[model samples]
Target chain A: MTRILVSEVGPRDGLQSIKQVMPLEAKKAWIAAEAAAGVQEIEVGSFVPPALLPQMADTAELVAFARTLPGLNVVALVPNAKGAARAVEAGVHGMSIPFSMSETHSIRNVRKDHPAMLAEIRAVAEIASAGGVHFAVGLSTAFGCTLEGAVSEDAVVHLAEAAAEAGAQEFSLSDTTGYADPAQVRRLIRKVRGAVGDMLTSLHLHNTRGLGLANALAGLDEGITTLDASLGGLGGCPYAPGASGNLVTEDLVLMLNAMGLDTGINLEKLLEVRTILRDALPDEPLYGFTPDAGPMLDYNERIAK
Target chain B: MTRILVSEVGPRDGLQSIKQVMPLEAKKAWIAAEAAAGVQEIEVGSFVPPALLPQMADTAELVAFARTLPGLNVVALVPNAKGAARAVEAGVHGMSIPFSMSETHSIRNVRKDHPAMLAEIRAVAEIASAGGVHFAVGLSTAFGCTLEGAVSEDAVVHLAEAAAEAGAQEFSLSDTTGYADPAQVRRLIRKVRGAVGDMLTSLHLHNTRGLGLANALAGLDEGITTLDASLGGLGGCPYAPGASGNLVTEDLVLMLNAMGLDTGINLEKLLEVRTILRDALPDEPLYGFTPDAGPMLDYNERIAK
Candidate 1:
């Protein structure tokens, strides 16, 4: 089976939902632990203003530290042209601009509509290109939006194509509000992949509707090889922060491994990272099935003796 | 999308595991309520002796009562020739015999080895054939057996063929001790299906390994249509008594419906059935997800005008 890359966004996505701010050292430790657990990419933190999201304030420090780890792709979430400049200056592998496809969510999340955000994405791409940093447009609410109700597939395709035209090296669809069903997922992904064939198609899905793994499977059927998952399934949008925002990384990794697909992630090692993270933020309600349920019949046994 | 059949087996498989016998009326009410909840087929009760399982002592009466309901395929579990004869005489729409592939489980469960059990199946088939009753042989321990470890794929295929030769109309593979991983499930189902292609392949899985839904998806991918689930995941082998067994019906139904595969069972009516069942066994643990997590975004909007 061709291996799939799982980007653990727990530190960035999972921690941001949590009220407590993990120490910069603890964040670095978590990143190292995750990299050792075979996580290829780690979205260490977001580049929003510290005043807005104190939890992600140490993003630059964490990213700089993460870059020292060999073979680790450190990506950061940049909200606009300013954050994109910071990510470029930090010299990470890639930076993602949150491109909201829903008009309402775009106005609420980034205070800009689709066309204006596309302009920012184009500028971010130019800045990243100048610095030789990869640019990925993370399109949030490609699935339906809670604020806007149902997001159009036409809107999603149009945004993805716009990002590609704006010089984005890659594109990923996020189920920010998690209203995606598998059929809609399959339909939208096919449309987007057709619009941007080889410019790196990926998905960032949430299990809000309990369809994270199902949506991932649909994307897989559409030839999407990269998937975004948060450890313990964390992350709540400021407007609607809840337990349903991001897909839990441990559960997603478990599904892929159980499907006989190599994810380079040892579930045992990955599960341990949750504990390390929990120690820093004890009140965080960590979510995942495989972690709490334990391994499916001695996954450790096969790995052990 | 073909509306997949989800046969609720909580009353029979789920309740039988506990020490307390939900009174005869409770079993009848559970059957009627689940039928009212749009569950098309249900294994209402097993025809085992009251001496062996006092919890299901009133199964015969429940079966007779369930038969009066409109459009319900009431099924009963028959461990040996005696139970099958009793179920057929009681006028059930379907009668299923548990044929353990493991010599150890067969010896423990029914006191008959594989071939001897084949003789018993043929005996029941002859008895049911005369009465024009539908017969299904569930290949219990088709995936590894707890007592007799590593049940060979050939042994499972052999039992499936034996049951078919003995004149059974339907076949299902159980994750008896919940040892099935999806890859293993896919392999065994393929082998069994190749042995009896399109011979009414069903899946009887457990959440003991926390991979029940994942295993169900594997079965669906392999073309096994019918899924057996217990409401609230109330199940454990009554052979030991007072322990939980079987996958939760609520979780399983939610998973299938979420994946866009239509299961005729309604989530709301299913929850209502649980309430009525709760009156019978107040302290008994009834498990399910859709009940706990509420409906998905605009579930009623999706359902209503």
Candidate 2:
């Protein structure tokens, strides 16, 4: 079986967008259930101020809990050096720092411009490396920005190069506003890979434009291994108007598994995990076609055969 | 711009699944508005029994109305020689006859077995050819079937060859149950094309599994030009439990336009047409991401630039 890594981001990304806050215990349960379903890694929480996002207040605790799971890599989203410090202290397996390519979104999201963000990347990389944590810089709004409009591809590639040079272990390009299409996905992945080579690690895409899986397929065709997805299609950027949410993990796994690529996920178990989310976040709407349509009859038959 | 054909099938495929019957005038207005938005072809209706599907009782009228529009290819779904005769007399540019590869789905959908369906194909093809109407065979359950599990690739290719031999001007494979994945799509298209060559003309896919557009992109990558979609993702098989509907047109055009593929659609105008459907079929739910999230800021920016 050809292996692909599916990194779950529902706890952090999905929770951050919604108004309802899940209890810390429920978060642990969700992570445990998903990890049991064969998710190798998960972004358990964000190291942001509780004042800005009360939803992520339990991120550190969640990370600690996530670490207890065998064979599971725990990750956290750190906005800057302070967040990085917290993440490193928490002893996470990986930390992702988002670097918005759009200057306006950069300021709006992290209160920093490109130069300032680059400095932060270097600072966090040093802290994470010293603490023996893997560091990745996510290029948010690399496809396009709602606030700043079109983000140039050259600028995205330049920032990827800069983040790599700043000592980051890996880089990811995000469709922060779900502006990515397959051609752009192919073009940008090829462009960035050409510029930074092995430094490009994963893709963070949204289904906001209904191209999430299409974009993921495009990434896979270009040899990308890691995919950032939120279980139940959990998160949406409250800041980005009209953005739906991240690619639903169940649907992504279904596509990958059907294509004969091994995600190592037991999809039936993954879907069962959605019940935990539903029970914890009762009012929140969960989205995915597989759940709605049920598994393909023939796919199930093939498995039985 | 590189060109691709997006054929609308809402009238025949979408309306057939809904119980609410749309008035003839509303149907006309709907088709007219889509044509004005630059849809090159519209499957106006199916020639099935009025009692079986009263929603499509106006198919012949719809086809006649569709022909009044300049540069638009009017199509109708014909289940047998009777439907084909009506389509021929109605003067449609094309007629699609579905040939199910699954034995069970073949019986359930059209009440005919493989041999019987093939014979119908020959009779319809002869009638259509004499009338100068292009005849295409749609291989339903080409991917898999709810009634019959695990449709074979070899069976699908063999059926395509049979349809062509029976005088089909073109052949199409449909994921009637939305069982297609990108890898399966690539493999099946290659296999079928190797068997039927240039006779393969279109793909009829569903978003039932949320892999609709991804599957379409896979088809495009394999050199498929014509895609069958429904405005607002209308239509679902009442018999096929849990299936969603056809691929949404606006979302499909948005991805195509962003990839620099010329769909020749004015998306703005296309979205406006949704209002007509909404008003006419107020109770029917509409689906598509581009309409919800709006166009990509960069894509619109590029259009402006």
Highest-DockQ candidate: 2
**Which parts of model 2 are misplaced by more than 4 Å?**
A297-305, B298-305
Which numbered prediction scores highest in TM-score against the true structure? 2
lDDT by residue for model 2 (B1-305), tens = 66899999999889988888999999999999999999999999999888999998888888888899999999999999999999999989999998988888778777899999999999999999899999999988788877776788888888888888888889888988888888888888899999899788789999998999999999999999999999999996666555558999999999888888989899999999999999999999999988878766545564343
Stretch of 10 with least lDDT, candidate 2 chain B: B296-305
Model 1 ranges off by over 4 Å: A241-245, A292-294, A297-305, B147-150, B238-246, B258-260, B297-305
lDDT (tens digit, per residue) of candidate 1 on A178-257: 66666666777777878887665788887764557767876776788999988777775666443265877888888778
Among residues 3 or more apart in sequence or in different chains, the pairs in candidate 2 whose N, CA or C atoms overlap within 3 Å are A14-A235
> What lDDT score is found at residue B273 in candidate 1?
78
lDDT score of residue A25 within candidate 2: 90
RMSD of each: 3.3, 1.8
